[model samples]
Target: MIRTLLVGGAGRMGQALGEGLSALSSVDVVGLVDPHEPARLFSAPHFRSLEDVSVAVDAVVDFSRPDSVVLSADWCASHGAGLVVGTTGLSDEQRSRLERAGESVGVILAANFSLGAVLSERFAAMAAPFFDRVEIVELHHDGKVDAPSGTSLVTARAIREARERAGRVTAPEPTERFTLESARGADAGGGVRIHSVRLPGLVAHQEILFGGPGEGLTIRHDSFDRQSFVQGVALALAHVNDQPGFFSGIDHLIG
Candidate 1:
C-alpha cells in the first residue's frame, strides 16, 4: 500500500483529495499537514507543520497555494518522500526551485489534473499545423486568483510549438489599433490570443479555436466539478515513487 501524506489538508481541493484517497485500497493516509488544525480530521494523524508528522510517508500530495509549493517540495525531498503537486500559478523561478529539490526525490507537478484537460492539450497541438489562426478562451470560478487558467497556457504553448515545427506562422492581425483596451485578449506565443473569463457557476473550461480557409475547428474541455481531478491525483500518487527527479504535467503518467 502507498502511505501518503497530504499537505494543505484543510482546503477545498485537499479535502476532496483526502476523501478520494480514503476510498482507495492501495493507499493509506499517514498524516495531514495544515496550518489550521481542522475540527474534524480524516483517518490520518493531523499536524500543523511537516516537522510534527511522526510516520515515514511514501509520498506527499500537495494542493496548497503556489507560495507554499516550493517549501513543501523541499521538505518532501529532505524527508525522502515522493511528491505530487497540484498547485498552480508558480512563477518560472519557483518552478526552477522545485526542479532542484526534485533531484533528491520523485516529483510530479501538474496544473490541471483532469485527464480530459490533458487530452484537450494534445488535440490542440495536433490541430495547430492545419490552421493559420488560433485563439483560446478559458473560464474558471471567480475565486481562482490566476487570470488565465494554467490549462489554457499549456494548450497555447503546445499549439505554438506544433505550429512552429510545421513551419506555419499565424495569419497577420486584421486590426492594427483597438478602440477599447479590452477589445482583444492577451497575446500568446505565435500570435495566439487568450481570453479569460471568471464566473461564479463555472468550474473550469477551455476552448481552442482554429480557423482554416472555409471552416473552423474548435476543441473544448469542460470540468463541471473539482472531483474530476481526484482520479488523476490518485494516479500521480501511485506512480510518483517510481520516477526520480522533477516532472511536469500528467502527460507522462497518461502515457
Candidate 2:
C-alpha cells in the first residue's frame, strides 16, 4: 500500500505533497513528523520526532532541513524502510550519511524533484558535449536557504559528466580575465559555472546555456508553485523500494 510518512510536513512543499498524496489511490500518508505545529491541510498522525512514532511505516519522504534530514535517514535505515529525500544544501558529511544508510535500506536523494527541472538537467547533459562553453543561472525565492539552488548544481554536474564522457579533460573556460574576484559565478563539478539569484518574486527557475562556435542552445525550467514537485515525489516514492542502494537525482526515474 506504500505507507509513507512525510517529514517537514508543515512547510510549503510538505503541504503540497500532502495534497498530492491525498489525491493518489495507491499510496497512503501514514503520518507526518515535523517540529512545527500540525499540518493544517492534513488530518493524519502528527509527530514532533520520529522517536515518538510507535507505528512502522514502509517509507519516508523528507523535505526537511539538513540536520533533520540526516536523522530521518538514520531512522529509515534502522527500521529497514525506504527513504526519499528532497532537501538541498546538505553538507558533504550529511550527504555521506544518507548514502551510508542505503546499505540497510533503499534511499533516493534528489536535489530537485520537479519534472521540468529533472528533464532540463538531462537535456543540458546531452547537449553539453557539443557546446564549447556552458553556464547556468538559477533563481529562487529569497527565503530559500541554498545559494546555487539544487537544480543548478544537478544540471551543472550532468553537464560536466557529458563533457567527461566525450573525452574532454575539462570544460571550456571563459576567455575574459576577471578584474573583480567575484565577477564569475561559482564553479560546480566538472568546471561548469553557476550563477545564483535570490529575490522575493521568484519561486524557482533555472536556465542552462550551451554555446558552440556560432550557435547556442538554451534549456530552461520554471517552477512557479511547489505543487510541481509532487508528481516527481510520487514517482520516487513508488519506485524507491525497488532500488536497493542509494540513488541520486530523478533522472533515473524517468530515463
Candidate 3:
C-alpha cells in the first residue's frame, strides 16, 4: 500500500482526497497537513505542517496553494516521497522548483485531474492539425484564483505542439482593431485565443472550437463536482513511485 499524506487537508479538495483515498485499499492516508485545522473528523491525524508529520510517507497528494506546492515538493524531495500536486496558478519559478524536485523523487503535477478533461486535451490535440482556426473558452467558479483555468492552458499548449509537429501554420487574425478593448480574448501562443469565464454555480468547464473549410468542430469537457478528480489522483498515487521524474499530466499514467 502507498502510505500517503494529504496537504491542504482542510480545503474542499483535500477533504475529498482524504475521504476518497480512505476507500481505496491500495492507498493508506497516513496524515494530513493544513494550517487551518478542519472541524470534520478524519480517520487520520492532522498537523499544521509537513514538519509535524510523524508517519513514513511514501507519497504526498497536494491540492493546496501555489506557494505550498513548492514547499510540498521540497519536503517530498527531501523525504524521498513521491508527490502528486493538483494545485494550479503556479508561477514559472514555482514550476521550476517542482521540476528540480522531480529530479530527486517522483512528481506528478497536473492542472485538472478529471479523466474526461485529460481526454478532452488529447482530443483537441488530435484534431488540431486538421483545422487552422481554434479558440478556447474556459469557465470556472468565481472563487477560482486564476483566469483561463490551467486545463485550458494545457489544452492550448497541446494544440500548439501538435500543430507544430504537423507543420501547420497558425490561424491568421484579420482584425486589426477592436471597438472594445480586449474583445478578441488573450492569445495563448500559436494564435490560439482563450476566453475565461467566472461566475457562481460553475464548477469547471472548457470547450475548444475548431474551424475549417465548411465545417467546425467543438470539443468540450465539464467537471460538475470535486469527486471527478478523486479517481485520477488515486491512479497517480498508485503509479507515482514507478519512476523518479516529473509528469505534467495524468495522460502518461493512463493506459
Candidate 4:
C-alpha cells in the first residue's frame, strides 16, 4: 500500500481525494497537512504544516495553494516521498524549484488532474495547425482563485507547440477596432485568446473554438463533479515513484 500524506487535507479537492482514496486498498491516509483542520474525513493524523509532521510517508498529494509550493519539493526529498502536485498559477521561482527537486525524487506537476481535460487538450493541439484562428473559454466555480484556469493555459501551450512543430506562426487575429478596452480576451502567447468565466454553478468547463474560412470546430470538456478528478489523481500517485523527474502533464503518466 502507498502511505500517502495529503498536503491540503481540508480543502475541497483534498477532501474529495481523501474520501476516494479511503475506499481503495492501494493507499492509506497516513497524515494530513492543513492549517484549518476542517472536519475529519479519515482517522489520519493532522499537522498544521508538513514541516511539523513526524510521521514518514511514501508519497504526498498536494492540492493546496501556490504559496504552499515553497516547501513541497524539498519536503518530498527530505521525507523520501514521491510528490504529485496539482497546484496552478505557480511563479517562475516555484517552477524552478520543482525542476530541481525532480532531480532528487519523483515529481509530477500538472495543471488539472482530470483525464477528460488532458484528452481535450491533446485533441485541441492536434487540430490547431489546421485552423486559422482559435479562442478558448474556461469557466469555473466562483470560489476558484485563478483566472483562465490552468487547464486552459496548458491547452494554449500545447496548441502553440503543435503550431510550432507544423511550421506555422501564431494564429490570425481580428483587425476590427475594439469599442471597449479589453473586450477581447487576454492573449496567452501564440495568438491564443483566453476568456475566463467565474460564476456560481460552474464546476469546471472549457471550450476551444477553431476557425477557418467557412468552417469552424469546437471542442469542449466539462467536469461535472470533483470525482471527475479522482482516477487521474490515483493514477499519478501510483506511478509517480517510477519516474524520477518532473512531468508537466498527465499525458505522460497515462500514456
Task: Indicate which candidate wins on lDDT.
Answer: 3
* Backbone collision tally, model 3: 0
Cα distance off (Å), candidate 2, residue 2: 1.3
Candidate 1: which stretches are off by over 4 Å? none
Q: Which 10 consecutive residues of model 1 have the lowest summed lDDT?
A: 36-45
By lDDT, is 2 or 4 better?
4
TM-score of each: 0.95, 0.93, 0.96, 0.95
lDDT by residue for model 1 over 144-192, one digit each (tens)?
8887778888888999899989999778987788899967898886989
In what order do the candidates fall by lDDT, top score first? Answer: 3, 4, 1, 2
Predicted candidate 2 versus true structure: per-residue lDDT over 145-169, tens digit per residue: 9788877877887788889889866
Give candidate 3's error at residue 120 in angstroms: 0.7
User: What is the number of backbone collisions in each predicted candidate, taken in the order shown?
Assistant: 0, 0, 0, 0
lDDT of 1: 0.87
- Overall lDDT per candidate, in order of appearance: 0.87, 0.86, 0.92, 0.88
**lDDT winner, 1 or 3:** 3
Best model number under TM-score: 3
In the predicted model 2, the residue pairs found to clash are: none
Those runs of model 3 whose alpha carbons end farther than 4 Å from true positions after fitting are none
**How many Å off is the CA of 36 in candidate 1?**
2.1
Give one digit per residue, the lDDT tens place, for model 3 in 1-255: 899999999988888888888888998988989999876536889899989989899999999999999999999999999999999999999999999999999999999899999999999999999997999999999888988789999999999999999999987897999999889999999989999999999989999999998999999899898888989999999888888999899998776
Error of 4 at 208 (Å): 0.6
lDDT of 1 at 42: 70
